[model samples]
Target: MEPVNGYYEASMNFDMEHVRPFLSQLEEAFSLGLDVDHLAKRVAEAEVETAYGCDLHLAFEGQPVNMKFSAWIDDIDAPDLYFYVTSEKLAEGIDAEMEKFCEAHGL
Candidate 1:
């Protein structure tokens, strides 16, 4: 939502009502070969105002792409959730594909 640096990011107001559906679509669209069950569980069990994340080793063109991802809240009392995906160094082609993927998914 800020700079187009080493990551693509997005944020929203947090709500469990939106968690499952959003995450379901996210995993389905971006998981590639990574199992996001742990991330799913962590987010599901998170307190309304809490934030956390983990690295997801998803596949891109049959090669593993490790991305650091986090779900953060701006305020504990009135949480405003945000998601960040980081890939410090990526091949040019892969970065473009990932950017397209994010755009397509409205991330």
Candidate 2:
């Protein structure tokens, strides 16, 4: 959004349903800095990259955005989903959306 902070994107393959929850976890991590949201934005990228051995990228509104992400279940087990985000503005929308989605699904 505002000139990429870094050139890399964090990628994780997960199930379709996991996309939202993973994003929620990330926001939780950033806000409370507890539990799995341990890595700062930068650290998230670094850690996920190292752990997965691939650069991660987030796609938002049909566009790819910079982010730190993770994939679960792998490609063989589940059709992995991705959670890619950039910009505080987008993050705001993501938080609101997550709440609504969670409420709808009783998550």
Candidate 3:
């Protein structure tokens, strides 16, 4: 497991940097109304699984959200899994963390 950008605190269990750029690209791609299916296709084209070094998806069980992101993680060689989160909740959490990180960094 490894940390990412000092922002992701949980053990990654894999290097996901390759997906970071994809994530950024997705954020940009959202400038216009994009079909969910097409978004999925784009994600597939990004090779998110291989890039993240894990098989994961934005939705688990089923359904996506406006502000949330999710991923599955496991120990090396373990079975793939699902991870889910609400974007609103994640944004709130991240804002709090950023506030603290910035304060600590004297920013």
Candidate 4:
């Protein structure tokens, strides 16, 4: 996707089994990830109808970072999940956050 207003935007696709791990990565990358982790846990274990989107606002060094994300699961024969994260302008940069985490954790 195109960077909106010079912010780095990215989306990655993976399956349901990777959910926990992915959340861990998010937890490492963003402050909002902790709340998202709890929300995801509730939905995953509840197995009931739930909203598929979460919006968050976090401040870094007194700067506000507003983020909105959508996630869904597909279970035709097996459960598969996808996520779309779009941040207009992130100070740390999504790419750098991801690369830094992955490199540190050897992921």
Top candidate, metric TM-score = 4
Q: Note the residue pairs that clash in candidate 4.
A: none
Residue 23 of model 1: what lDDT? 53
Misplaced by over 4 Å in model 4 are 1-8, 42-51, 76-92, 95-107
Clash pairs, model 2 backbone: 9-56, 10-56, 11-56, 12-70, 12-71, 13-71, 14-80, 14-81, 29-37, 58-84
| TM-score, predicted candidate 4 vs. hidden true structure | 0.53
lDDT of 2 by residue, 1-107 (tens): 33246432334344444453655565554442223333223233332223322334544455656654444333433333333446555556645555665566666
Q: Candidates' TM-scores?
A: 0.52, 0.34, 0.25, 0.53
| lDDT (tens digit, per residue) of candidate 1 on 46-74 | 67555777766676545666656566544
Worst 10 residues of 3 by lDDT: 75-84
The clash count for each model shown is: 0, 10, 2, 0
Off by over 4 Å in 3: 1-15, 32-67, 75-107
Q: Which of the two candidates, 2 or 3, achieves a greater TM-score against the reference?
A: 2
lDDT of 3: 0.34
For all candidates in order, the CA lDDT equals: 0.53, 0.44, 0.34, 0.50
Against the true structure, candidate 2 has what lDDT? 0.44
Q: Write the per-residue lDDT of candidate 3 for residues 1-107, one digit (tens) a residue.
A: 23233222321221333233333333343332224344333333443333222222343224543332334433223212122234434334444544454454454
Q: What does candidate 4's lDDT look like per residue over 1-107, in tens digits?
A: 56565444454433455556656666666555346566556436533233355656665435666555545444422233323333444534555555664566565
Lowest summed-lDDT stretch of 10 residues in model 4?
76-85
